[model samples]
Target: MFQGFNLNVSNESRFDSPSTYDEILKSREDNVRESLENFYNEEGLLNGDSLRKEWFPEIENCHVFISHSSKDRELALKLANWLYHEFKIESFIDSTVWGFADKLLKQIDNKYAYREETKDYSYEIRNYTTSHVHMMLSNALNSMIERSECLLFLNTENAIRNISLKEDREQYTFSPWIMAELQTSALIEKKQSPNSQRPFGSLESNKTDIESIVKRAKSFQMIHKANVEHLNNITCENLSEWAKDCNGEKGYNALTTLYRDYAPGCR
Candidate 1:
């Protein structure tokens, strides 16, 4: 359990220098490159466990889980990099997991779910496979959210849209994955760290055209309120202050700085 925040951040905001941001992107690319090797085994077969590991995030270095829309991926990446550069706080971006889930599904369907006779994939088997993969990915995301000390949701226009249903204005998100993440953040057990004596804080949808998965998401009535009222709503300005507070501090103390100013009530 941890603290969560909904930040109405500017997508254009650049928190780190160009070179520094490039370094962050390079590092992420390198990490992905390494993980790519694990997709196959000695027999050149898709290793299910290895693919599963991609969704089952065991990120020891990450203290934050960034939840945002696929369109705001660059922004989320920038925020994650900023957290690391400013406060040495690593963050887990769910976009990567979504990618891996797609890859895993492609590998499975290409291998087993296809039918040469019909010149198309077996719809039933594909559905069965996707259900399992999505379940794992969803559970893994929940796990990451629970394990991290903070969750920062980038409440940008790209993430949510305003809808007026019968004169009642409400927020609606197109992606069911985002809906699940927000709901999980809302209901998950809120646990304070042992060091709460100090302070506190803080998915992308599938891209594959596999059986028109995205179309199915659109058919669902996922009307969310973009409920961040319960969370501490912070701005880029507040983040700057948090950075200033972190200037003289080190390690966990720097993180505590955020809790002190924003989540003093957490114990």
Candidate 2:
């Protein structure tokens, strides 16, 4: 991880509308779909190495990794487009990879886990496959975060909650994915992102309650403490200035200043 930002965004935020980048997103999805098609052989079986390579691709130059709730995917796409338009920055949006993962799982289940007796996929097989797929996906995501120069996590009420825990207040996120990313950002080796010249870069369960689970399910189920204290908290106001400062020839200088202020002694 080079640097991380917990960017507060909401429905009222400028990034809410993705219409501006609809065409670009369509093109991107099409490209990804086509690339995935190559992973299937004439027998219709997926190549293991190809599939693994899809999950863990080589690090690219000058990219930004946008970490946001899947619910905020449109917003993330919009932000990605905005970054490209304003600063010629590319972004690694994992949701694209996630869609591929879902497709891959369906293919795997349909081929091997389906049971004629049950008229559905085997629960045991599904669990087994899911475990392997999720584990690989988690590893791939961490690899990207470590490789990217900066990580901007979209922080919204949709993803986090403030809970009253005994005498103290604590922040938590229901998404295990968010928890994992935050933890990774906190622990990963920090190095200057090539894209700072360039661009881009969970937990637990178990419990023994019914009413408690139901109430929390609608809002804060399977919570993990939000580990954003290590990140720079950025608001829309800060984003606006960052955008202005990143224009034209000032872009590199502006980023250098930002790194200097936020990450002293960092190259």
Candidate 3:
């Protein structure tokens, strides 16, 4: 955790004396300042390639990847923690796992420290635009998705608003990162053998029966309205269809249903 502010470190003797407590607090503040300075000097700025190589290696295994907008980081973390506690499922949230990106972004925004007129600011901007930041981020995300068993997209209001489907096209054109992750998950699911894993049910199960259930799900359209236009070209077998099937009007009952049907063993 980043610790640049004064810390509340208590000792039995210090707690009895206000002056001593104040002195301890001041000491902690000094230590924190020194640590922060050293951290910045060590990490440097605008070194995406080196950061990527050192920080994000590779995720060999994980149960799920929670996809959400940066705005909903708290909610995403809450969900990840809950999933791990309830079902013993390991999950990845970018804020925690890929925190170097967050730190770099924060450093960039610290105008007082790295003044806009300084060469550091120019170098930072140039690297953000021309360096391997995007590529590294994409690679890291794809690696996580590739290793995970499934993706749990947190469809909160913020996430939906950020990546709302376009009316004109049958494909997602906004929120490139979310769209890319979803497409990657779809591709992974497609590559898996139909008989190998049956999270929802047997692929050989009655097609007519599956279609009937899907039709019923679609009937809830009034409550859970999605961009049907975007879903037109997607096959019935696609996981996207499962998401559409589970969307209810208010809460995520439909999402629960989708998970129950597809990833049955998950809590």
lDDT of 3 at 208: 68
Best-matching candidate per TM-score: 1
**Which tens-of-lDDT digit does each residue in 58-131 have in candidate 1?**
56646778899988888887787777776666678888678777776776776778766655678899899899
Candidate 2, 109-191: lDDT as tens digits: 66778765645557799889888677777887888888767788899887789987897888888888888988999998877
**Candidate 3 residue lDDT tens string, 1-267:** 000001111221211212222332233223321112333435465454445544454443455566765776655555555444334445566544445544444443343233434323344554554334467777878777666544566444544432334553232323556666656655553223121243321223344654675489555611122221211121223333554454432122333444454442434
Candidates in order have lDDT scores of 0.72, 0.69, 0.43
Which ten contiguous residues of candidate 1 have the minimum total lDDT? 198-207
Give the lowest summed-lDDT range of ten residues in model 3.
Answer: 1-10
Best by the lDDT measure:
1
Clashes of 1: 5
Alpha-carbon runs more than 4 Å astray in model 3: 1-50, 102-120, 123-130, 162-174, 189-260, 263-267
Model 1, residue pairs in steric clash: 4-202, 5-202, 151-202, 199-259, 200-259
Displacement of the residue 16 alpha carbon in candidate 3, Å:
38
Stretches of candidate 1 above 4 Å error?
Answer: 18-51, 194-225, 264-267
